[model samples]
Target chain A: MGVSVALVITMLELVGLFTFATSGALLAIQKGFDAVGILVLAILTALGGGILRDLIIGDTPPAAFTDVMYLVVPVVAAAVTFFAHPLLQRWTFTVLIFDAAGLGLFCVTGTLKALRFDLGPLQAVLLGVMTAVGGGVLRDITARETPALVQADSSLYAIPAALGSAGVVGAYHAGLPLGIVGTAAAVFVFGLRVVAMVRHWRAPRAWTRRRPEVGR
Target chain B: MGVSVALVITMLELVGLFTFATSGALLAIQKGFDAVGILVLAILTALGGGILRDLIIGDTPPAAFTDVMYLVVPVVAAAVTFFAHPLLQRWTFTVLIFDAAGLGLFCVTGTLKALRFDLGPLQAVLLGVMTAVGGGVLRDITARETPALVQADSSLYAIPAALGSAGVVGAYHAGLPLGIVGTAAAVFVFGLRVVAMVRHWRAPRAWTRRRPEVGR
Candidate 1:
């Protein structure tokens, strides 16, 4: 039962990968990238976080190498966008919805992977956050734009991912039903993030005029 | 003696960081970046790899937050480049030399850190290679170009860094003086890389045609 649940989650995560890849390719197009650049950005946006996660866990070759679907999905998404960009640009809100789904799936998947590696809860949560944001971070860096997660005064994107991961792990330790508990956690995170975005909720900034003292 | 040797290496690494930061700032200027972009590129080029290394190792806040010099050097380098870029552009070769030195330092430092954390030889070497090339990889992605490391035909950048790091670790285990052996290893790597660049030497590519058997 747990294996089946994990499989379903993995499948959803792949869907998320494709969505993110399309978004990346669209951004590349907006930036006047040629075909090659669009393809590269798509691949990076899809696989970059997973690659980082696997490398940190000492997994050789990485899942991006082993899974044929992972590679095919991104390439196909980029090619589709290349051909249908004129039509797709009309559905901008739809793309953001897909991007949000990808974010949620990746956050949970990353947390689960970290836990499987026997990392502590804090480390697991951090890994989850990194996995959720890493691809977008790579995308922004590639586009030479300030990473929205870091620079924008927006609701806590990483914080919610961390919270969701912690919740799932907590429920798992408490011997809850895997599918029900995991789904609940994911929905909670996704819904909270949507609310935050809609309401324009943001993390408080402790703005100060005084320079903080530095320790040697 | 060990402390003094580490300090000296750290100082040299700072110099290299400064040079790379200046180069990054100049690139930003050529790309028509404003002040924030210049600072972003400068810091990213200088400290990006070390930050990634620390994050992968599950170190919080990273070394950039711990060391004042690490933060200061890049900013100072950016300011210098902002004011002196016209003159510096004439000395491109000199800047490249400094960049090479920084690359050597980062590779060795990364390898040593991995070994200290009790990772095996292969893992240590991989970490060393990533640490050396990771920043530049980010830089290229930011610039929307193919990473020099992964391009089909490029100079032997990562290979030498890996070999040099492995050599240093191997020599250390064989009971060589740490300072002398390490410095020699760095110089060997730097010289080999320079030769490769000058001679346009590169790793041989394997030809693959599109075929069903090729598993595309």
Candidate 2:
């Protein structure tokens, strides 16, 4: 990877990590968790997806554990949220944009990584989506709520990640430059997610409450 | 490893996997999940810890995915629970014993595996406890509940797993025979867990509610 590409990926991943960590901290506050709980949620939200990806891909100890900055980023985000709740709360829109960027970047990166490990393109795309959304799934679980990925109330979320990942895979197969592929995929996902948020575009939910089947 | 020891470990692990899967299925039933959710929970709860362990230790794709029996056990367990909810519901104590057995075996085996991978005794013991409790954690999270391991209302669960892992580590470092050491540790965890359950030996909960602090 070129130095600039490497730099872009790292920066986007960091942005995603911080946003998810903030989300986690906010949930912790809502759940009335003490300081320890906030930290726990933030750290998990930041690292959970990557950890799961690393584990599945045979990456031991996970980069988050080996690299100090990854751990420090979540801690800093959580601390900031804990200390400045109101100020940060008002910047929800800004945070969402960063989060969408992070999601887009992670999906592309995770898919490419999985592909490098010889996973099928389909599997790679799934891993990409998982990388994008896994952290939030963990965050919700920790806070005792249905994961937003699977919730009825949420707008299209995982769909954008999947679409972004598929785009990267498609671009790679078509021999596009890696830089262009990654950037285009991330922008598409980020743009779609932001638009979905604003316009309230939603994924269809399952038919509501099928009548309980009669007598077993 | 001796054939006898290997056989014993396999049997115990199967029992553990089945029980944990049952626990997952039961929880899914409680949550009113459909067939797909029940199976997902069952399989995840059955295989999650081992998957996490293998990943941490750099084992890719996880053994559960490759081994058909491992996949089959949870599927069967979920199907049984789905078909015979009332009958299985009455067998809760039986399921608990099996779950405890699985926990004990997993902790012992997980620690031994970590040791073989050259993880320090401390890290190995932690992996051991993780292997014991990881599945249930995934199950609870998927169902949007605090894991019983981390819950304040639960009896000593993770404690027995930890103690079992510790004992194996202690025994190994003390230069005991592996067979005797592993069996003893498993038995100890199993006995402790069952006794704790029977006695309702609760872990102390943090004080009910310190009145949520107001005014940020």
Best by DockQ: 2
Off by over 4 Å in 2: A2-48, A51-102, A115-126, A138-146, A150-153, A159-216, B1-48, B51-101, B118-127, B137-146, B150-152, B159-216
Error of 1 at B209 (Å): 3.3
Q: Which digits, one per residue and each the tens of the lDDT, describe model 1 over residues B1-216?
A: 368557655765687578668766766787788999899988888888877776665565777789899899999999988887787545545545656766787787777766665556655666676677777676656656556554334577777887988986786578666667667777877898888877887754322122112100
How does residue A200 of candidate 1 score in lDDT? Answer: 75
Alpha-carbon interface RMSD for all candidates, in angstroms:
12.6, 7.3
| Candidate that would win on lDDT | 2
The CA root-mean-square deviation of candidate 1, after full C-alpha superposition on the true structure, stands at: 10.9
lDDT by residue (tens digit), candidate 1, A1-216: 369777866776688789889877766665555554566678778778887888778764466655557777998998887777767544445555555666777778887788778888888888877777788788767666566676445565766777888986787578777667666766777787777777877776666799554321
Query: Global lDDT of each model?
Result: 0.71, 0.77
Where is the poorest 10-residue window by lDDT in model 2 chain B? B206-215
Flag clash pairs in model 2.
B16-B102
How many angstroms is residue A9 displaced in model 2 relative to the true structure, after the best TM-score fit?
A: 5.0
